[model samples]
Target: MRVLGVDPGLTRCGVGVVEGVAGRPLTMVGVGVVRTPADAELGHRLVEIERGIERWLDEYRPERLAVERVFSQHNVRTVMGTAQASAVAMLCAARRGIPVALHTPSEVKAAVTGSGRADKAQVGAMVTRLLRLDAPPKPADAADALALAICHIWRAPAQNRLQQAVAAHRTLKGRTA
Candidate 1:
């Protein structure tokens, strides 16, 4: 499956497209950021994000979209912009009938780095290594976006499979007892 992962921000929203399935290597299709002046009106910033998503939809037409869940930060204004930007991304995905998944920053970090407390630099380093990229994805936000997509792919059904395996192991041990 192909997925477009987005990290929404008013100043610089990161986007990444990755294609793969469970047990298969996910390859980077594209990674970039959408930008609007910090001073730009909220509506204009949302339009910018919408336009960016539309462009990606036209070019890649990913089957699924993954966006970072809106988080309330200390700055209410920042949080508001993020929510607006995220809404635009979700709307774009919905318009195309593409399924959307929203993951929290901690969840993405845990999936990528095996720790929910991982900082941006750590996640970025792991993402670069996981994708086997020569260099870190440009701009920290872009790397975070790619990591978010990879995390979703790794944790989705794969988590269930792992749980099943553990259950089976326990059952076998119980039978032998």
Candidate 2:
């Protein structure tokens, strides 16, 4: 499976593409950061984010998009920007009919580093080892994006089965009712 992972931020949105299946080697198709000037108006920044995500979707042709889920932070302003950027990513993927998954920061850290409390350095190290890269990706955001993709590749199968089971149970319950 090919996945495009997005680490959304108003200042520097990270984007990475990875291709692989379970129990197989994964390859980094591409990795980069999308930058929007902080001074830019919010609408302009959002538009920039949309264009960046759309370009990635067109170029990578990913089957799925994994985005970092926005969580509460003391800085409401920061969280709002992150949530906005994340929405832009989801919209871009939805337009192309690609499946989008939102993984929490802890979930991504655990998946890549075997610990939910893993620090940025630990996650970067694990991502480097997993992808067999000589060096960890830079700016922290890039590594984060790759980690999100790796988490989805490893978890999506079981997640899909769980979703199917829930849907089946709902259908059965409705029929009985």
Candidate 3:
């Protein structure tokens, strides 16, 4: 499956595309950052994010979009920008009828590095090795976006099975009732 991963930020939103299934070597289709000037107005920043995300969706046409879930931070201003950028990504995917998956930062770190508390350097190192790249993707954000895609690719199979099992149980219960 081809998945696009987004690490949303106000100034530099990371974007990456990966294609492969679980238990196989994945290919990095593309990786980049969607940068907006910090000095830009709030509305303008959001619009820039939207345009960047839309262009990615149009080009990659990923089957699924994996976005980093916004979490509460001490810096309310920072968190607000992240949430806004994330919303723009979701909106772009929704408009294209692409399925969107939200993964927490910890979840992504654990999936890629075997530790939820792994540092950015460790995550980048693991991502580099996993993707067979000679060097880690530049700017921690870019590497992070690739990591998110890798995490989703590795976890999607189990998640699908769990969903199917829940549905089956519900159907069986309904029949008995």
Put the candidates in lDDT order, highest first.
Answer: 2, 3, 1
TM-score of 3: 0.95
Candidate No. with top TM-score: 2
Residue-by-residue lDDT tens digits, candidate 1, 1-177: 788889988888899988888678779999999898887777887888899889988888888888999878799988888898889999999988998888999999998899999998999899898888998998998998899889878776875587799999999999999
Ranking by TM-score: 2, 3, 1
- TM-score of every model? 0.87, 0.98, 0.95
Determine which window of 10 residues in candidate 1 has minimal summed lDDT: 154-163
> Which residue pairs in candidate 2 have backbone atoms (N, alpha carbon, C) closer than 3 angstroms, thus clashing?
none
**Per-residue C-alpha lDDT of model 2 across residues 62-107, encoded as one tens digit per residue:** 9999999899889999999999999999999998889899999999
lDDT of each: 0.88, 0.95, 0.94
In candidate 3, what are the lDDT values of residues 1-177, reduced to their tens digit? 999999999999999999999999999999999999999899999999999999999999899999999998899999999999999999999988999998999999999999999999999999999999989998889899999999999999988999999999999999999
Which stretches of candidate 1 lie above 4 Å from their native place?
158-177
